[model samples]
Target: MVTLRLKGLHRVKAKGRIYWYAWRGGPRLTGAPGSPEFLASYNEAVANRQSSDSGRFRSLIALYRASADYKKLAESTRRNWGPWLDRIAGHFGELRIAQFDRSDKIRPVIRRWRAAYAETPRSADYGMQVLSRVLSYAVDPLGKISSNPCEGIKQVYSSSRSEIVWTDSDIAHLKKTCSAEIAQAVDLAAHTGLRVGDLIRLSWSHVGEDAMIITTGKSRHQREAIIPLYQGLRDILGRIPKRSPVILTSSKKRPWTVNGLASSFSDAKKIAWPKGDDLHFHDLRGTAATKFYVSGLTEREIAEIMAWEEEHVARIIRRYVGRQAAIKERIQKLNEARKS
Candidate 1:
């Protein structure tokens, strides 16, 4: 048995093996002693659990944590929710859920978030949205909270992007300079209009002979995606040797984790755009939308390819590429009039 000196922490031996456990009966530690899990679990077990039944806030959060809905969420989603929910639990955890009214408590908390994360105001907005959802759930047929305090909370954050489309020259330079891995990622994003998350998670099975099917990530709805497998995407996939279940692997031949992929792309981007253009991996989706428009696809057809709403597609094409086309046609007509 390996013994480590730590408060409220000990190792138990059974069948010639030692296991770490919290001294008092708490959740079993999952990692090696003195690891991240050990320290977190130790602190959790030994921390003060002084809250009583006086407030339904913590209790309601606990109930929601154990609900089927929270449990069934995708791994990436639940991971994103952890820190946000933990913050909410820490902020008003001891207050009664029914008393979360906009007149005082809720607005104050929202303002605090807005002020604290002024640089990333979107994060603060997201926190309010999360709180609102919990409040809505509490006000549902199952719970005692009568109203959602987060209703009509103004979204002060503007998510407008000045992302420029990657020209053919830009894409060619990126493919030549970038590693074979990320180059392929860029190509798939441009041709198929898939997000980085979806690209990294894509499998050989998802790519049929003529079309690739996908379940989109990071959307309110898990949209069914079906984009045709064009020659560009076909050539990219054909050359890559399959080492993992995921189609795109890292230089180490392992499947790319989301953060890992981002880091790699960041490095590749510096090489590709040395002058620091305002392009990102996601900007390829807009590039794809433009390319579809130039190829004579209607907004409705482009919407189907990208799995986006028709109105959004129409607006984007009109604002960016389609308007330019219309202006050029007007100029051509004016030239003909002058000739007459």
Candidate 2:
């Protein structure tokens, strides 16, 4: 039952889309301010209350409502999803709420966006996914549209296909060459398989007597990773002062950004080994998942430990478990030879 009333569309000089002052007093436009075509389109949509159908408009209204219930998301989830929401807003900020439908007109827009970001499939996939969700929510339950245009969109953009699993040497080098904070970050990634975004911001409060209870941003699963207080992690955690809220932090004792940590990890990797960029922090999670998978842990168990959905685990296996079967077969042959 979301309603949007159009105000006047004004032309902006730079990269401006249509700007409509809503009945609720918020401005809407398709693109960022200052794009020429954006300004013209904003004015056109506002002037005539264009009855044209668009999925973008419906999606925006749903997003607005969803944002109102922000508390439902974890702090990290909010931080990550915010950018996607902004990008969607930038593309369809000014459309009439009621005019949203699956139209051929928007296909080219999606196609263009997909093409522009062909190299980075993950970003493109995320954009499409957010758009799809928005549109799905906008569709009337009474069969207004036969189907969502976003259906069957390829996930080539947001996939783990490009991800690389870390080797033992990579782990050893990172531990040896990185700073204390960075080393701790690497250890946590290795042991817990948490993302840099989640690991760097983790606090003593999230740790309990037996395990580290982490909430993932990529999904809603609440995972409690049990890293049996081994000497290394225990020693590292023992060194932290009682006053700090996080495990890895700056001299000022603040959380680190994912990019910042990734940069540091990269620098440390370069100094520690010949191939610094061979692996990413995310690969640690993949490695851990592989370890569990090899140990005959069910996909559900791996997902529980990693805080990923079941399908995500399957996807990871398909993408990265290349040598697992070969290694298992080699072991089997060795065992048969020994028995003979």
Candidate 3:
């Protein structure tokens, strides 16, 4: 019997076969010695393990990825964080976390990412935010890093793009060119005031006889709500075949991954919406909220219906609610005062 010692390779015997896995955490890889696949797996594992043990960015990110808090993040947020985190881990991942904690040391790295992603300032800013969280996690629970370098770094806000309520024309155009799944996704997003992430995860079980009853996942403090199963949303739901556990499915009848949904929707937008300024799926949620307000629902009432905070509902009203209607209400007060 020979004792095998490989830095990142752990050999385990299962079902009369041996398997190798990266010591830190990753997918399993198998390659017999002297085989090309084995060599590639070994090399890749060694690299990942080296970075993992180096007490660097990947090490901290790995910890954060495995955290319960990470799982608690909305699917959209988690999806957004992953790429930015990976990019940060790639550039600064080699440095020790302590080394990364130094403001002076990390400034240059931050500057480069900012410069590189200058066209999309929000992405750069979000990268900094993700870095801040990763460092914070390392400090509180993992206790590996002492300071958060992302805190002091200034971030820009160029990603703030205004949204338009999808018009009847817009819906008609989309319906003409897009698949039923994507078009229905559009309808569901606008008709229900739920975020795209929440809408995509809606299940058959969440369906009620006259309403959609489910807990939304936009924020950490999740709240359940029941929106009436109106004709539009009900039509979309009724038409979608029960292919997977979730109501929203791809043309293949498979469930959508966050990236897949984003990509598919983006493609749909480009093809079906070639005429003017494109609308984001999230704008539909805002559009729904504004409709709720114009339909004479109070901000608090809207909040209750949407399972959102009153403050959030108010914010949406401030941005998108009809100003003419607001002025009309104010004029009624003036008329009352004259009558008095």
**lDDT value, candidate 1, whole model:** 0.71
- After superposition on all C-alphas, the RMSD of every candidate to the true structure, in Å, is 7.7, 8.0, 7.1
- Arrange candidates, best TM-score first: 1, 2, 3
Model 1 C-alpha lDDT per residue in residues 1-340, reported as the tens digit of each score: 5456776664556446776655522224667776777777766745523343636576666666556666666656655665677677777777766577434666666677656767787887877777776777777845566677677667768655533677789888878789988877777788888777788888988988788888877553467667887776788778888888888888999999878989998988888778787777787887777677666676788777777767787676654453454466568678889999
Whole-model lDDT per candidate: 0.71, 0.61, 0.72
CA deviation > 4 Å runs, candidate 1: 1-55, 101-105, 141-147, 162-169, 201-205, 215-223, 230-260, 289-340
- Inter-residue clash pairs, candidate 3: none
Q: Candidate 2's error at 85, in angstroms?
A: 6.5
lDDT of 2 by residue, 134-164 (tens): 5665564424445566775567644453346
lDDT of 2: 0.61
Off by over 4 Å in 3: 1-58, 71-86, 94-96, 99-105, 119-126, 142-147, 152-157, 167-185, 195-210, 215-225, 229-276, 293-304, 307-340
Ranking by lDDT: 3, 1, 2
